[model samples]
Target chain A: MTAAIELNAVEKRFGNVGIIRDLNLSVAQGERHAIIGPNGAGKSTTFNLISGHIRPSSGEVRLNGDVISGLGPFEINRRGLSRSFQVTNVFSRMSVWENVRCAVLWATGHRYAFWKNVDSLPEVRERTSQILDDIHLTHRRDVPAGLLTYAEQRELEIGITIAGGANVVLLDEPTAGMSHAETDRAVALIRRLTEGKTLVIVEHDMSVVFGLADRISVLVYGHIIASGTPEEIRRDPKVKEAYLGEEAH
Target chain B: MNATTTSASNISGKSAGDSLRFYGVWLVGIATLILLPMIFSSGGSLTSFSLIGIAIVFALSYNILLGQTGLLSFGHAVHYGLGGFAACHVMNAVVSHGWPVPLPFIPLFGGLGGLAFAMIIGWVMTKRAGTVFSMISLGIAELVASSSLILRSVFGGESGISTDRTALPKMFGWTFGPQIQVYYLIAFWLVISAIAMYALTRTPLGRISNAVRDNPERVQFIGYDPHVVRYIAFCFAGFFAGVAGGLAAINFEIANAAYLGAIQSGLVLFSTFIGGVAFFFGPILGAILVTYLQLGLTSVTGVWQLYFGIIFIGIVMLSPGGIAGLIMMHRPLARAGTLQTVIPSYVVAAVPTLALACGVILTIESIARTHSGQSSPINLFGVAFTPASPMTWASAAILIVVGFFVARLSWRRVADAWDRAATIARDRGYLA
Candidate 1:
């Protein structure tokens, strides 16, 4: 079967500095994968490249074996790839329900419709409320997204990312600022929502990485030094020296 | 499946109530429009009402960009003026060719005219959203305004092109020759346009426009190109502006260079912003007040435009949300029945506020009269005073000094009362 995402020798540079060099990564369909590395390892850059937020300097990026290197972010989104930012990014002025509904609109093929009332669409409304319920934000549906608690905002961020029903999900540092309890709840939510879909998460928390990811990739200095199961990754000497060893302290 | 069915039923039940309230508001609005003429039958009032009707459409169109889509346009009058010119030409052509088109259908042609130009201009203009977009709109407004003077055949030069409204085919045995008939015609179009525009805010495109306004980058990740959304909104704004322009043509029977000038653009912007861009009906209130002020002030004072500038600045600095925002801020107190707590303080504040306003007006008027070298006695609030007299200057100075200090003290009391009411509202769960 074709890989869900394939970055073939993807190289990215800013001026003369190489941020990502010869990065060849493959994520299989329906697998939960984790990418862990030191700070400035270009994990976020990899997500940007695959999501078409930025173009690779020399190599192509693919979604489900189809090259989408030069496409715009919206075009890439329509092709079944969705992502959440490290910083909580949302439609701050819109209500929580509206933020989710915005994501659901395009996925349900309600593109550029001006004649139909959004509330009158039973499917869109149902799907939106369902996602809000999943994120446990149904009670706060009427509150503006900006007013939500930080942890709640992070949940809202993940909710919007997956609300489009994209098959390929990329979440960057979803629980970065979350408390331990919030992180656990978020991990459970992510696991439930992304079931049977391809998920590639960039995480700093070792517990979340080992507990959630089916397989792991270790990135350092813009290159992956190890790719294996959680046990194998834990045992890998190269990964330990480059990343896991520092976390051990 | 069971959850979906129950939730769907709940939505339907809730929407039934929402739709009732929605239709009720529209019905009240329509009834008021029908009764306004009965209450105010004077020809001058009818003319003023008709002008207010046209301004309502124009200002609301402006809000579609500034309020909904967060696109600040400086050249919206181009569409309005172009639409007026198109309506005038179509009216003259219908008469010359003996076409059977009536006056009621003329605005639709004007809408099409505005839409066509928007399609051409907005294609390039909507690519950028912020300062770049504003600069381009300003440039385009200048281009159109200057071109209107040079394009004599189409624009009619300085004299403008005029047509007779009575020349159109009669509808319902009304020639639209009388001011009341024209007022009714305008009122009819205003209701239709307002309803159409309001309905648009509930649509998918409308919600997405709001999303784009809040965060354009986030919109991109949700499968929408912000540029496309802005372009569509720009076109709709242009179309409604043109409809207002068409109604103006029918009312005045003329289209002129002044119609497309910077002042026309600024006035629509002023009305929309001052009315409050945050609420749907903000521009309606704005259009009515601005239109009344424009007409009433012009007759009462030579420096009427100066008052408009001051009012605009005051709204921006004191309450960025405008009139609608100010009214909505009191909603929680009203719902909690604590509004009376703030009322006495408001009354106290009003006295000094009125004095301050009178003082500012007196000073400006005196200076204006002196600058113009006019020695005639100035009549203000039923009192006549010479502009050159030291007594006039001293009274103005006294009002300014006393009003400034008193108003400051009174406003502090008002703010304290507001806090008390707001706390009560919060306890009652009326405020968040």
Candidate 2:
């Protein structure tokens, strides 16, 4: 079976400084993968490279064996890849319903319908409400997404990411700022929502990485030191010294 | 059970009432448009009203860029002027060849002209939005406006290209020769374009434009090229602006270099923003108010441009939402039936503020007259007073100082009343 995502010898440089260097990573289909790294390890930059937010300096980022390095972010997204930002990036001016509806509109092939009222599209509205329901934000659907609390906005952001029904999802620290209890709930939602799909999450939380990921990659200073199942990663000396450390306990 | 039924009925009742209010406003607007010429049935006022109608379309088109898409364009008049010039040429062609096209259809050709230019320039302009796009637009406007002077064959040199509306074939026996006929033609387009632009706000492209405006990156994740959305919106805005220019061409029987200038672009921006960029009708209100001020104030004073500047500044500082926002702000109060409680306070506040305005106007006008070497006595609100008199100067200073203090006190009262009323509405759950 083709891998869901593959980044081969990827190098990213911002001006004169190297950020992500010679990164090689792959995730098989129907697996939950996590990338845990120290700060400034270019975790978000790695996500950006794969998601087409920025071009890699050198190397191939592929989805399902199809090269996607030079494609625009939207074009990449259209080819069954969707991503959530590290920051809560929901449309602040739009109501939560409209936010999800926008994603659903594009996913459902209503990219440029100007004559028809979007609300009248039963499929769009139903799917939007379904995603909103899955996020447990049905009550707050009418409020502007910006007015939502931070945790709620993150939930809405996740809903928007998966609303497109993309087979591969990249979530950049989906629960970065959540409380402990909120983090548990978000992990559960992510697990349930990303069932049977490929999820590559860049998380700083060791507990989340161990508890949710089927496999994990340890990245340090723009290079992956180790990649294995969570048990193997726990035992790998390089991963333990470079990243997991005492926190693996 | 009773509560559930009542709440359900309330929801349906609210939507029903909302739609009723929506249609009612449009009905009233149409009635006002038809009855306005009748009420002010004069040659000059008709001309002014027709210009207001044209400006309404122009401002609405500008709002598509500034308000809807959050793209501040400094060269929107490029399309408007091009459309007008195109319409002039079309009119000239129709007359010279007797193409059998009626005067009413001339604006379509203008719209096509605008669309052509927009298609050519939008690819490059829509690549960058915000400040960069705005600067590029400004540069383009200057380039085209300068070119208009040099391209005398196309722009008719400095005098502009003129064509007779009467030269075109009659529309069902009406040659559109009279200003009233032209007024009707403009009003017809004003209604059509306003409705079309409003409908656009309800479409997917419109919603996505707002999305792209608020968060372009998120829009990308949703699988949309923000550039494509911005390009389509720019094209539509140009098309409508061109249509307005076509109307202007018909109204004035000329399309000139002035039509493409920064001043024309600035006027549309001022009117769109002053009316309120947030609301759809804001630009319409702004266009009419600014046009009226332009025509009415210029007749009375030479400082009309200064007044426009003052009004633009005042609206920006006080109510950035413009007139539409100001009107919408009172909506909860109107619905709560407590609007009357603030009215007396509003009047009290207005009294001293009007005095302060009068004092300032008097000072400025006198200063201007003196500068121009007019030694004549000025009429201060029907009271003739010599500008050279010490009493006049002293009284003016007193009015300024005292008016300032009194207006401040009254303004406080107005704010207090507003807060009190707003608190009541919030307590009653009438405000969200």
The local distance difference test score of each candidate is 0.90, 0.88
Q: Residue A180 error for model 1, in Å?
A: 0.9
Deviation (Å) of A71 in candidate 1: 0.6
Candidate 2 residue runs with Cα over 4 Å from true position: A246-249, B1-14, B375-381
Fnat for model 2 comes to 0.59
After superposing candidate 1, which stretches have Cα over 4 Å from the reference? B1-19, B376-380
Distance (Å) between predicted and true CA of B79, model 2? 1.1
Worst 10 residues of 1 chain B by lDDT: B1-10
Q: Report the lDDT tens digits of candidate 1 across residue range A154-177.
A: 999999999999999999999998
- Model 1 chain A: which ten-residue window has the lowest total lDDT? A139-148
Taking all chains together, each candidate's TM-score versus the true structure is: 0.96, 0.95
Following a full C-alpha superposition, what root-mean-square deviation does model 1 have from the true structure? 3.7
Give the per-residue lDDT of model 2 (tens digit) for A1-249.
Answer: 999999999999989889998999999999999998889899999999999999999999999999999999999999999999999888787777778888888888888778987657778878988998999998777667777899999999999999999999999999999999999999999999999999999998888998999999988999998999999998999877877674556
DockQ of candidate 1, scored on C-alphas against the true complex (2 decimals): 0.55
Clashing pairs in 1: none
Candidate 1 lDDT at B97 equals: 93
lDDT of 2 by residue, B180-243 (tens): 9999999988888888988887777888888888888889988999999999999999999999
